[model samples]
Target: MKKILTILMIVIMSTALFACTTQSNNEIKQDLVVGLEAAYAPFNWTVTSISDYSYPISNQPGSHVDGYDVQMSKELARIMDRNLTIKAIEWDGLIPALNSGEIDVIIAGMSPTSERKLQINFSDEYYRSEIVMVVKRNSVYENATRLIDFSGSKVVAQRGTLYDDLIDQIDNVVHQTPLDAYSNLVAAVTTNVSDAFVAELPVAESVVKSNPSLAIVKLEQGYGFESEESDITVSVGMRKSDTDLLNEINSALSQISVEVRNQMMTEAVLRNNESELTLFGLITKYLSLFVQGVGVTLLLAITGTFGGFIFSLVLVFGKTQKIDKKRDNIFKKIIKRISNGLSTAYIVLFRGTPMIVQAMIFYYGVKLITDISWWTPLSAGLIIVILNTSAYIAEILRGSMNAIDKGQMEAARSLGFSRIKSLLYIVYPQAIKNALPAIGNEFIVNLKDTAVLSVIGVLDLFNATRQVVGATYDTVTPFIITALIYLFLTGVTSIAVNYLENHKAGKELKDA
Candidate 1:
């Protein structure tokens, strides 16, 4: 009970931290991997493919990723004469990677909150954004100029963000549930799950632009929670230990004029209109969103894979022990049935549905069952992972069970043993011998699957990489390191599983 409550509390607190940010998978590797959520248009967003839109990137290699951060990172790479590599990670995970010595810089649009300062260091503020409200033009909130106007109005912010906290300050403002993706928060407002979304000005403008039916109301600077240019000022994230690198970046940033920075911001906002344009325009426009979404993409694969193994366990029965038939029947028919069925149910659901849909269902769907609020994302994520994994592992079990040979079960049955007793004593032990290799593979997949939890906001490794991008503004170093760490973990798990399989198989052969 204590453990469950603690887990529940952690999950609830996590929701309070969601935020609106840019993301993209639209770009994976530049010379420098600048991580950012590119979904925010004007700043970043995913569009189709394009040519003739070269600013700083030499490689648009096909069409998946490009954006404002890409353009800026490319320019920064140009200034420094370094190759650019873009790694897209989630909004929250970026920083822990930076502090842990994974990424070299965070270029994603991020606020240098005082809390973040304790983990790693930041660069000089690069750009400043404002706070605003986004709502349905027909909603009562359409005329809301200050947060105070929304007393008792339903409000929702991106979970795990500063805005989520900011939205909580309004008197009786009725803070509604948070969402998985910051980009999706607008949908909540448009759908009336929330009256309006509190966000940075760039986000509001881009959202309002992409969606004309929406209202973008800027509250009087003091009336709404407005951070100063210093507060909204975003910076490059770097390690304090690398004073030399920090010095170099600050020098580079100082050289760029405010006018150029403003123009960059403006171009980012303008690019948000790409969806209505020609194919080329669309490509040039949302390339950034594509790039930033990489974190979530990688996350999906990693979590799906790891989640498969955590829930499956090998069970064995022994025939030589002269076990009682009644007890064996209870184990197989009752306990085993329930446990196996549960594991099976999870797998069928996860494998049956798309992971993205699962992620959405996790964040939004589960809320109807509880008011604890925080369990919404965490439970949804684990359940999806658990389910996805069970499907693959169940097949592994069935195959291994078949490999044990029917003769063993019959041999045990011939000796006064009941059907359940015979199978437990005869068939199960050997099945474990056969299934070892497949189960190991599942673990490797699960290790990677840990990344998927980032979507609903578990700050696992990939998400850590994303936060790094936001904090540092530099990109190439973080992703390479992040990938290497994942590789090392998978490699280690593979070896351990192999050793166990070899040990158990050798024992099995000796007994035979």
Candidate 2:
């Protein structure tokens, strides 16, 4: 059943990936990849058909891309006549992907804040929305004017947003965790992950329309925030050096109007007032669920760690000791190839290439060669994590082995013990004692690294919380709930590691 599930997951992931990434063959010069949260309705999202809209959305052929940014990009593409591509990346990776030249333009609804400007350039502001609190319908916070009304209350906001920064301005409110996107913000609130969340008007309006169970708490004038806070202007982000792309995007923004942008919003958003929402609905309402994606990440970390360990030990054995036999001779040569290869290429390749590429290859590369889906999300995710982890673990184990005094090996050999026996009994035990802290450290990192699994669609704590934030449009609560969960997991891991260290000291070597 597990194998079948893994295979099925791989197939589904591959199909979704291909559908999302496969490009139409409209001729062009350069591929202009625009990154955005496609789940942001009225701005961008994947729907069954463009025909589903009450009004046509910016003339997009399919039901995927719409809203101000979509319209502007399409209109600009017509002007440039280059193949415009949309790459839906997480909010956090947007600037980095652009800086690394993975994408040409960040058409996501990002604000050109002062800090963000240092890393990337931006086109002029295209669309702006005001920040507001989303709460349960007619709740105490509903129509409650001013920050004082919600003082001592919990508030959540998406990380790195102006809303997050603004949360701190409130003197007494208990700020929970900061989420990464609008979607998780809603999920946070809807799931009672948070009490209320700060979001822009556009997102809040859409959230209320999509989930009728929620209410939008409009701040009365003088809401104790900057005018800029109320005006959450979103613009296209570009790399600092991409002057050409920046200029092209600016030109595109000039031709668009406020009216056309709003029209797209009306068509894309479906009004709903329900209490319960599906993951899909919550995801569409908010794009942050991707952050909490989990199962694959955990699988990736554990398997990667274990694989790296076994592979490392074998390599270490071949490198450190000598063996003699006809079969041993063949094994020695094979080990030599592996050892030398590990030093030269394997280390460089696995460590050098982006994990994302490796993951994509593991997940979808099956389509090119065979019908069999050889990778499960967890297995595939772990394969890369392990490949990367093995390099580090291999180096650590090698170092620890060397740290064992050479004399110990000599004495063990002189005492009539085989090389393998000496290594198993005398060497590895001490090396592991030395490596315990490092191993513990790695596990903690592994826990956090789980967030990366969101790309592959594992809804772990972060991804799950992100869904809540996105759906509730309440960023703080969901994030707080999820963050606490992460902290708890990490804390438990730390306790376990400490216990192991103490146990080894008492039983094996004395003194932890």
lDDT comparing candidate 2 with the true structure? 0.65
User: lDDT tens digits, residues 323-407, model 2?
Assistant: 4455477867777667666564665676677666665555445423444434434455666677667666666776898888999
Instruction: Indicate the TM-score of model 2.
Output: 0.58
Candidate of highest TM-score: 2
| Candidate 2 ranges beyond 4 A from true positions | 1-28, 39-42, 46-68, 187-193, 229-231, 271-310, 313-315, 318-383, 388-451, 455-512
Question: Can you write out model 1's per-residue Cα lDDT over 1-512, one digit (the tens) per residue?
Answer: 99999999988776654321112222332344455554444555433445333232111222233445656766777786666655444555566445543346887777777767776678888887777778888877787787689888888887666777787778987877787555467557666677888777876776666566688888886787845454567788776687877787788888888888888878767654422233344334433433443443444445555555444433122212233566676555565566555655565676677765666555444443444533533345656766666677766766787676677777776788976666556665566567778877876676576566664444455554543332222233445556776787678778888899888879879999
The Cα error of candidate 1 at residue 266, in Å, is 1.3
The best candidate by lDDT is 2
Model 1 residue 392 CA deviation in Å: 7.5
Model 1, total clashes: 90
